[model samples]
Target: MDNDFSVDLDDILATLRSHDIVIARFVTVHRRLLFDFRSTPLDPPLVAAVDPLPSIEARYRHLRELRPRLGDPPKLVTVFWPRFVASLADTPAWQAVRGRLSASGHPGAVESADAALAGLVDLERAAQREAILGGRAFRTIWSASPSPR
Candidate 1:
């Protein structure tokens, strides 16, 4: 399977459409991907996309590479990747980019984030299931506790 987290734009757009989130504007500025949308054609819970988000396997490999110095590689991998997803909208990098986009009067400059995220989660769950065997694959793959010291 492809290890990269790169997602197909058309597939993602289809998922967003399925969620009934209207795409006000979707653009990539300076190679940073962003999407602007509302929960419905006219509504609240605006959302934007932020990506290059790593996959579970990629994240696991990265931590494993740290080797002897790494404390509980599986644990770190489990905690970090989900944390990365949760913190996407709050990241300073994304917030700064959002600020600039809003200042420039760009459409989809993240008013408040959500609906698209929900759809993206749905897409991610399906993809990951196919990659492994089932949902929350990380939990199964990383469930082994570190050997006792």
Candidate 2:
């Protein structure tokens, strides 16, 4: 769907409130990869998207609250890819309240498991982030045009 991020801040919060704002984390340790999901809330609760205040601190504060929920990373006990998944699985020891889980070998999942694992390792740190931009709500700043100087 085409989202108009160009809208006012109120609209931004409205847009966020409309959907389930979540930050996803793909973590790994040893040899496992898993996906973690957290609910990101909108500030001011249910204020109708009317006039948007210049500062985003209001909305940002709510976003920051999500940090506690995100807890270090997307710490999910469920494993997606072993090794990388295991790697992700290993990081969230505290999040794993329901005892320890195991990773299943995807012997037939991919042709180059080693290459995939290497790629995951390389991307581990970089990929760790909020799911806000990951979603389509806001256009990636990098792709935005430079302002006329």
Candidate 3:
């Protein structure tokens, strides 16, 4: 499985080719960011729809590779994708996560998929959730999450 994503230090990817909007879910019980999200761009307005994950195995394989880059062990985990809904991105949350990523050296760029998936986090913390999914639509920004989650 040459394409299988088993992230390693040797494979430190500077950028991911895929564009799935990773809704930074929240810190899990183990203190890892729970990045629950779908593979394809959800809101059509944010980005052009992409093909769904070829299979569950493909989805998990991505998670396995992405988690290490997010932190280390217990860094991130793609929790799950909820039902279809018109969720909006929280300005604060989106910026906060983007800032965090930026500080980590992977500053996320503003994009429609990022805006669209900004509010799709699965968090119990209302304020935090609001920050992540708050504010007006970021239609002005231009970026694309065209990969599978």
Instruction: Look at candidate 3 and tell me the lDDT of residue 44.
Output: 20
Residue-level lDDT of model 1, residues 1-149, one tens digit each, is: 32344434444334343332222222211111233222222322334433333565653453344232433222221101222242344545345434543543435544434444444545554655655764533345554688666
lDDT of each: 0.37, 0.30, 0.32
Q: For each candidate, what TM-score against the reference?
A: 0.27, 0.18, 0.26
Over 90-133, each residue of candidate 2 has an lDDT whose tens digit, in order, gives 33331231121111222322223334434555644334332344
Screening candidate 1 with a backbone cut-off below 3 angstroms (N, C-alpha, C), the clashing residue pairs are none
- What lDDT does model 2 reach? 0.30
Model 2: weakest 10-residue lDDT segment is 43-52
Q: Given candidate 1, what's the lDDT at residue 126?
A: 63
Report the lDDT tens digits of candidate 3 across residue range 1-149: 01232223121121121223332222211112233322223212122222235555664565555442332222222322121222223333334434433333322333543543433333223434444566332232433666565
Where does candidate 2 stray beyond 4 Å?
1-25, 28-111, 128-149
Clashes of each: 0, 15, 11
Better of 1 and 2 by lDDT: 1
